[model samples]
Target: MPVRHFDFFTAERRLVHTNPISLLKDTRLGIEGNHWLRKLLQNHVKEPAVVAMGGIPLGLRAAIERELDLLK
Candidate 1:
């Protein structure tokens, strides 16, 4: 099931005094799927000095910088 659906089910279950489904330890990666990539990008953008020095194309780099500024 999708995360949103599972979240709804969990909330409903709590209201009914029932336990929510347990998170699967073994399938964590399959479920989360590299959530760290967003953090990695955010970290890179947070450091403007390093962003200016990276070898990415000027246009794409500018776009990323703009998005980072908005995120702040």
Candidate 2:
């Protein structure tokens, strides 16, 4: 058996090639960011004062409540 020398750097003084990859995106993580924005607008709908004061189109209150369905 013969021993070989290994050099960690090139003449340019940069790292020699050793590939290490990263995962930048994945499908399962989408909803980990998905819901909060919608929840913000729905917040106003949950408040009785805002709803009574005409929470936008008025019909939106019912829709938001249906979506929340918290007890179930």
Candidate 3:
């Protein structure tokens, strides 16, 4: 359920898949939660910051952990 959006484009075409934060935005943990979550798996993000996100997305947590070696 926790899937991020991805966009791939070429000279003549574009492809997009989006799964931006859903229910979280509807809760008390809205935009602020989204900002950090957006940064979670990025190459520049480090462990401490990742930890501060409070938690990871339901389905993607495992993959995120694997991608972020420190979390593994």
Candidate 4:
């Protein structure tokens, strides 16, 4: 079995990333939540754009679903 583990780190201050690709490449790409990966991606996205793309929250939801689909 692939033994999975999780841990969390809180920067003294919140960190923001304008470029997610670079952020992902950064070694600190770790999170505590089971959906941390998805949450991180959602956080980097500007909320206004999310609302503009569609009044619904489907964009991130779709992205998250797509990611999970690929994992399976």
lDDT of 4: 0.50
Q: Cα RMSD (Å) per model?
A: 12.3, 20.3, 13.2, 10.0
Tens digit of lDDT per residue, candidate 1, span 1-72? 324455467687785453333443344323333433343455554555555787543354665567546534
Query: lDDT of model 1 at residue 34?
Result: 41
Considering summed lDDT, which 10 consecutive residues are worst modelled in model 4? Answer: 2-11
| Candidate 3 local lDDT, residue 8 | 24
Residue-level lDDT of model 3, residues 12-71, one tens digit each, is: 265433455452354563223454456664543445654667775444566455644542
Ranking by lDDT: 4, 1, 3, 2
Better of 3 and 4 by TM-score: 4
Off by over 4 Å in 4: 1-31, 34-39, 42-56
> Which scores better on TM-score, 1 or 4?
4
What tens-digit string does per-residue lDDT give for candidate 2 at 1-72? 312222322435765655432332342333222343355455544555655676464545576567546422
Off by over 4 Å in 3: 1-31, 44-59, 63-72
Off by over 4 Å in 2: 1-55
Per-candidate TM-score against the hidden true structure: 0.25, 0.23, 0.20, 0.29
Model 3 is weakest, by summed lDDT over 10 consecutive residues, at: 3-12
Could you tally the backbone clashes for each prediction?
0, 0, 0, 0
Best by TM-score: 4
| Strongest candidate by lDDT | 4
Ordered from best to worst TM-score, the candidate numbers read 4, 1, 2, 3
lDDT of each: 0.48, 0.45, 0.46, 0.50
**What's the CA error at residue 14 for candidate 4, in Å?**
23
